[model samples]
Target: MEIFFCKSWFRAKKCPTEMWCEEQAKAAHEDGKPYTVLVGSIEQPYCFLEVTRRAVGVSFLDQLLRESLSYDFQEVEPGILFLTMATYREFEGDTGKVESGTSYIFGRDGAVTLRREFFNPQRLETSASSADVAANYSPKPEFGRYEDLIRVERSS
Candidate 1:
């Protein structure tokens, strides 16, 4: 799967040229598989502002999709790929903190099969400062099955 994270317009100076972005979009469209162009914004974290489609035309690339963060995941399992991204921030003076994480599982066809998001509740509630929290913090293990199947036998 070809996944591109496009930066918003205000950051145009840091983005690729309009023509280059269009060429990339055109190539992805021609491949005829699952390709995603996600528009990103500074105001939003852990989510995309928009998912651009080919039908929108190259002109749309001018407005968005200029800067891209591309990722090419190799199949970890048969026909499956996994990706994870996280953000951890500690406020100045250890007054507060923010921790957010997300994971994605993609199929060989370039479709997302599973997505998981995690956040620290302490960040929202009145709790100890970041330093105090860190002193007692212990990372917890998360477990789950990515796939499940069921079979039934008919009684004669």
Candidate 2:
């Protein structure tokens, strides 16, 4: 299965990224498999939260149903139309917050799995001491590993 990532702000009207997602959704439906779409927009702060919140329990299935109806994809049974948003925020000094990155696993059973991460440099600083900062900060193992599973495309 091919995963698509749209690093553009989402629009209400059909955009190239959305069109690609729709096509992938349709193909997954035809193949009787799940579908996932990752979207990144710096302007939308709540996009990641909303997607994750809706993905817990039965709500995710309900969300997929609603999206299928809205996007006119007919029916997507036992499928997950996963969407995510990534953004970054910088502070006054050298501090910053990065809410970004997503991972996917293609299971042997033909299921799609997702994982997301949020990194905040401010949280790593316990005090003004460099030792404390060094002790608290460690590179995330999952960082930079998501590229193995996704294909990124920019919209015009």
How close is each model in CA RMSD to the real structure? 16.6, 17.1
Q: Rate the local accuracy (lDDT) of all candidates.
A: 0.26, 0.26
Summarize candidate 2's per-residue lDDT along 2-99 as a digit string, tens digits. 23423222334222233334555445434544333433432222121111112310111112111110110111223223222211222233322234
Per-residue alpha-carbon lDDT of candidate 1 for residues 86-147, written as tens digits (9 for 90 to 100)? 12222323222224322233333334433333354532322111111111111111111111
- The segments of candidate 1 whose C-alpha lies over 4 angstroms from its true place after superposition are 1-23, 26-74, 90-156
Over 4 Å off in model 2, which ranges?
A: 1-21, 29-34, 37-45, 48-156
Candidate 1, 73: how far from true, in Å? 6.2
TM for every model, in the order presented, reads: 0.22, 0.18
Evaluated at residue 113, the lDDT of candidate 2 is: 42
Error of 1 at 115 (Å): 21
